[model samples]
Target: MDKVQILRKISQIFFFIYFIFFTSFCLCFFGLIEKFILKGSFGSLVLKLVVIIVLTLLFGRVFCGWMCPFGFLMELSYKLRAKIYKLKKLPKVSEELHNKLIYFKYLVMILSLVLTYYLATYAFCKVCPIGFLTNLYGTVISLIILITFLIASFFLPMTFCRYFCPLGAFLSIFSIRPLFILKTNNNCVKCRLCEFKCPMQIKITENVNQKECIRCFECKSSCKKGGISFSIK
Candidate 1:
């Protein structure tokens, strides 16, 4: 209801438009045109990859929070699951379990890198269900991708990003540095509102690294005590 929350909501909306609608649309259209009309060129593919990597470095995992089709799908699915199953009322996983699972993203990233190195392509992107959905053009493969997306959504909360999203994993390393992080002051009341607002289910108070944090500013907006602020160090 406050200005901060309003701004956060607006920012999220902008992210949805940029990442899901605009970027995905461009990538899908470009890929199709290159493969069919222009004939796939190695140069074009490499250029696209370079652009994505540069964006990641410049913005951290802002792409994950803002532009990733899978992230958007997960958020939408979370809302639906909350409505259908009343899951919003349920307590998040225990802190012990949550922290442990946080490492899963990094593990997935390493595995994905290995696979890409061996396969000479981003294997995860090649088979990403969300990416496939965004590019769906009537293919049996898309059907399989759809099924996978449904199953993941029904079972786990942001399961793809938590356990399988190699890009999320890739970003974790960059996020650990003392830069572009939400900092808290001593006035902190430990209200724990930030923890709840974090969609990644991170224990924001204890571990700031929180690989799952997308820098969405949800926690900063949620802090009623005005204890949280941004820092780049």
Candidate 2:
């Protein structure tokens, strides 16, 4: 791995540990939103949400790339699967299918919000895979949900983040036009290495400012030709 990828791995590990120690305060953004709706007021958790929104607006979804504990697990699972299969690179969904599937996250986000508001409960949290990780006492159904998603990640890589994570969907709203974005330069050979490396499977060459981009810089680091860079957009 390149320096940027190494740094990102270190950041993911550190934040995963931090998350374990502060699970209550570091609940996923969707869970926090559920809490705010159920209580009908803002709290410290909401303050954290505000901070996340600001950061996402400026830097894209850095939290997913660098901080999310569950995302870290998904990455690990993907790596493990590759190792077990002795594959140079895992297969990716077709671009047409990927485009269709990505919108599922947005639907999940809207459904979560609507359910939380109408049901007067933390409906999403009750089954959230991240919540399941933090709260081991969750129901058997939650355990099934967690295992299912983890297995999906092993096969598809970040399946939850790309297609089902309400938090990712919510963050995408602010990250679509973040201050900084990944861009390709004149040196690009269209090798498509960056796309293969992208955990979120973003088509960086086609659109660097895509909302699904996690700002991981994998594309930048993977480009041996120095074709990709993160810059002010």
Candidate 3:
């Protein structure tokens, strides 16, 4: 394989390793999800927030695409769905509805924050489906909810990140001008292959630096002519 292909493979491996660590039933490094679900009180959350947000301000939602355990599960479920529906794909949502749906995450983020503050507790944690993957060892309901979400991921790929993740809502605020951006060059053929591959469903050719971009680089890897590359500007 070419050097670019090797690099892409390396990136995939890194993401898989990160997924294992992030979702491990016992290990704790950052433990953002566990802290949110297990303990109602924030523990070193301000520090974690500052670090991740600063990184997002520089790199966009790399955290969502590469590191977040729930995102990993959702993407896996989506891939399974694609295989199941190989003969007949699901209908794509209208662009109008898609645009509106993008904003739903922000609303949920707001509600979560308000409830967290008003209740003086981590309000959503009690019912967050992510609890099943966390160290908390959640209840039977959490298990069922987690299974439901995994099933739903087939229909709504990365649904929680797109519509309910508070961290995504926070990170997206600063993604409009990431320090490292994906750019397409003259080699591009406008084949739309990259667009089809994008999990964020971005029109990547037109809006590589858009606020919603997650910096997953799937489009970069999918591009056939080496048209897409990271640019420092």
Count of backbone clashes, every candidate in sequence:
1, 0, 0
Candidates 2 and 3, the one with greater TM-score = 2
> lDDT value for candidate 2?
0.82
Candidate 2, residues 1-233, lDDT tens digits: the string is: 87878899999988888777666656477777887888977666677788888989988999888888888888899979888988665568998998899999889888988998999978887777766667733567777878898899999989999999888999999888888877899999999888877878777778765588887787787788999877887
For lDDT, candidate 1 versus 2, the one ahead is 2
The CA lDDT at 132 in model 3 is: 55
- lDDT to native, each model: 0.60, 0.82, 0.67
Candidate 1 lDDT, tens digit per residue, 1-233?
67755664566666556544543344332232224323335444556545655654554566567556556666677657766876533236777887687778677666655665566554455565655444533355655865776566555556666656666776666555534566678867888888766667766677665456776666787788888876554
| Candidate 1 vs. true structure, TM-score | 0.70
Backbone-clash count (model 3): 0
Q: Please write out the lDDT profile of model 3 over residues 31-114, one tens digit for every residue.
A: 354356456644655466667777777877777775565677777888788888782333256778878888888887778666
Tell me the spans in candidate 3 whose CA falls farther than 4 Å from its real position. Answer: 1-45, 84-91, 135-141
Per-candidate TM-scores read 0.70, 0.93, 0.78
